[model samples]
Target: MIKRIFAALLCAMAAACLSGCAEQTPPPEEHTGTRIALSMASRDQFLVTVETSVLEHAAKNQVDCTVWDAGNDYVVQMQHVKDAREQGYDALIVNEVSPSLTRGILREAEDMPVVFVNREPEMSALTVGKNAYVGSDDSEPGRFQAAWLNDYAEEKGLEHLNIVYLTGIEGQASTIARRESLMDHLKVDHDFVYDSTAQFDRAKAQVQVGMLIEAGRSFDAIVAQNDEMAIGAAMAMQAAGKELCPILGIDGTIAGCQGIRDGMLSFTVRQPGDEQGRAAVDAALALIAGESLDTVSGVTLGEDELSLMIPYEPVDAENVEEYIS
Candidate 1:
């Protein structure tokens, strides 16, 4: 009986030792370098340019980056976030499909850090410790447009300007902010002859402008939310045998820059797609490494010192060559 009792005691001691050893063992080493999942909202021209920059920066920084195209679907974007979390992606860089859908994305990310680019999420969705945004102030581009138009109108000696405003995606934050900024700063004597949403597509803008022209709406200038829309409007005006006036646009894309050089567009706001992309990558990597916003290299953080806004470069006939291909 004494021997059996001693054997039982020895087994209990061994079990406790094994349990302690297991508990003390460290988890398997994580993948080297900062692993990130870049969730793109769509494959539009601006986004494609940004994606190229992101890839270049990722290669330079040796970050393990994977891209998932959401195809402009909010549901797919949510699924992408879920998959990234389960796949152990260290961080998520999302160009949200829609800002209003941010809550679902945030909830799906749980503890994983999400670095939003281009489109902004709701302020409430930005958890200080887990999320950050990187982009230009949307209003700045509009202000730039207004400033240029104001100067142009003064030079042209126009007393009360007739304007046609071409807008982007209807519910987009950019669309709302840019329009508001332009309207707020526009000269008091200006008249809005026509305003319509073109969904930021050149084809759509062209069709809408053609219809307006057919309807006999007269305007001295066209202010587009983006270069594509401006270009489209120009094409429509040319097709209708109407005299084309100074058409302004934002997003100095390669094509947009060419338009300015060729005298198709009056001017454009060059929102640095490449620079923004690089900055976003750096921001995400910093978040993954538990680094402060101040430590993010090459990005100027906002007053909150968490988000980064790249300065908008104005591209017109004088500076179009520098931005053009």
Candidate 2:
């Protein structure tokens, strides 16, 4: 009876131990508390591509990243910058709302790293901050578009052609550079007129462009600063019975590629928005780790200046289907 009692006690104790072991949970996974903030100008297709690309790179590097859209408001962007700085982010990647507005706010980031991905404002602190920029040359694409339009018009035997320029948010460096490049390469003798600044608003773009066509504005081509505006222009032109004109846009988005294939637009410069985002993350990491970033002067695509001097492919009817589809 004593042996049986002892055995019963041992069995109970062993079962309890086994149950406790079974109920035990593993330790919590360690998070490094390293966080980076991405501030984009708007929710348009160009920014979307860059944001998506950057997120992919961030995940691979185990970076805890948060992205914010400024809605194209300079004030809101400044507030976002202030919030990002105050929230103890390890780094900041800014696609500033206005190229100039964020410079002053960046001063608040004393010692906290800040990187500029797309827009380039002459922030005196940029070099001192040990920051790097990543973007393709916006100017070259503008030039390429201008020359291509000229060539196509001549091929079609269209003379006395008039250009209608649809600009982006007024002060973006890309806008300035692209417009100037377009003017410089296009036939100076012909007319290149500014239709209006859509300010990166797609609906506004459609409305304003539709009004222009309704006003009977004579234009041989509609030149949009980016793909979103180009799409809006196409819709407006189609609605107004002026869709026959060649519509050119920048930022070779998936939609832009599709536009060319469907004969909605003449051509687009394939600028990789994704590459910009991925570069921003990689550049920020390099900056934080005290590693040498390649001296990217003009504009950077990633950690390097890839084809800085006009690397855009003009997606036309012959190649658009294969490339875009």
Each candidate's lDDT (Cα)? 0.86, 0.75
The prediction achieving the highest lDDT against the true structure is 1
> After superposition on all CA atoms, what RMSD does each candidate show versus the true structure?
11.1, 4.8
lDDT of 1 by residue, 77-183 (tens): 99999999999999999998898878888889998998899887786768765778888889988899889888987887877788899898878888999989998
Q: Across residues 1-325, which tens digit of lDDT does each residue of candidate 2 receive?
A: 9999999999999999988887796665676667899888777777787898888888877788999888877777787778888998888888877656655756766666778867765544466436666666778888888888888877887776787888887777888899899988887346765467987566777898888777877777888888888888899888877646888888778888888877888888887676667778877876787765653333333423321222556667777776665
TM-score of each: 0.87, 0.83
lDDT score of residue 241 within candidate 1: 94
Clashing pairs in 2: 135-300
Model 2 TM-score is 0.83
Identify the leading candidate in terms of TM-score. 1
Enumerate residue pairs that collide in model 1.
none
Q: Which stretches of candidate 2 lie over 4 Å from their true place?
A: 1-32, 295-311
